[model samples]
Target: MTTEDSARLAWFKSTYSGNEGGACLELATTPNAVHVRDSKKPTRAQIVFTRQSWAAFAGFTGRPR
Candidate 1:
């Protein structure tokens, strides 16, 4: 599999991410993968997740059932 460039990663902060930068986690989603990275280290190693796995993880963010 080919890894993507940090610069090319289109990072999107959560709506909770205010100007204070307390919530700095960034996410990037591609055709078959989702990426999670620290906004503080946008140029460093990023966590990769398969589309299916990401869907599960993202679902948890909605509510703790």
Candidate 2:
């Protein structure tokens, strides 16, 4: 999606992000894809991944605590 489109989604950051001074990721989930971006630089280009791809990545990463 374009940056304009991504701006419309509700982005969420990990709990650890605050503690680490924004050194973390943020995500916006949509029906078909998940949007990922750096918490430190939200306006930068983000990565868009299919729901299935995101799920596999989450599984491999073991989900953030």
Candidate 3:
């Protein structure tokens, strides 16, 4: 990803992300897409999800603290 893309990306860690920094999910919002990827591999192929689908997933997963 280019610096512009990286800079434009606003990433959020999954609620389930471990405090110890193990496996974690990173979320980034784009104008027309949402980017999902492993924190451990920020440069790897990012999984793109639509806004609606992402919302559905978040709802389905729910918040489990």
Which one is best on TM-score? 2
Per-model CA lDDT versus the true structure: 0.78, 0.85, 0.82
Tens digits of per-residue lDDT, candidate 2, 1-65, equal: 67788789999995557665747989888899988899888889999999999988877956676
Model 2 residue pairs with clashes: none
On TM-score, the stronger of 2 and 3 is: 2
Alpha-carbon runs more than 4 Å astray in model 1: 1-4, 61-65
Please tell me which model should have the higher lDDT, number 1 or number 3.
Answer: 3
Displacement of residue 64 (Cα, Å) in model 3 is: 19
Q: Candidate 1 lDDT (Cα, whole model)?
A: 0.78
59 in model 3: Cα distance from truth in Å?
Answer: 1.6
Error of 1 at 50 (Å): 0.7
lDDT of 2: 0.85
User: Please, what are the lDDT tens digits per residue for candidate 1 over residues 1-65?
Assistant: 23456567677986657789674888888998988888777777889999999888777867667
The positional error of residue 39 in candidate 3, measured at the CA in angstroms, is: 0.4
| Number of the predicted model whose lDDT against the real structure is largest | 2
Candidate 1 colliding pairs, count: 0
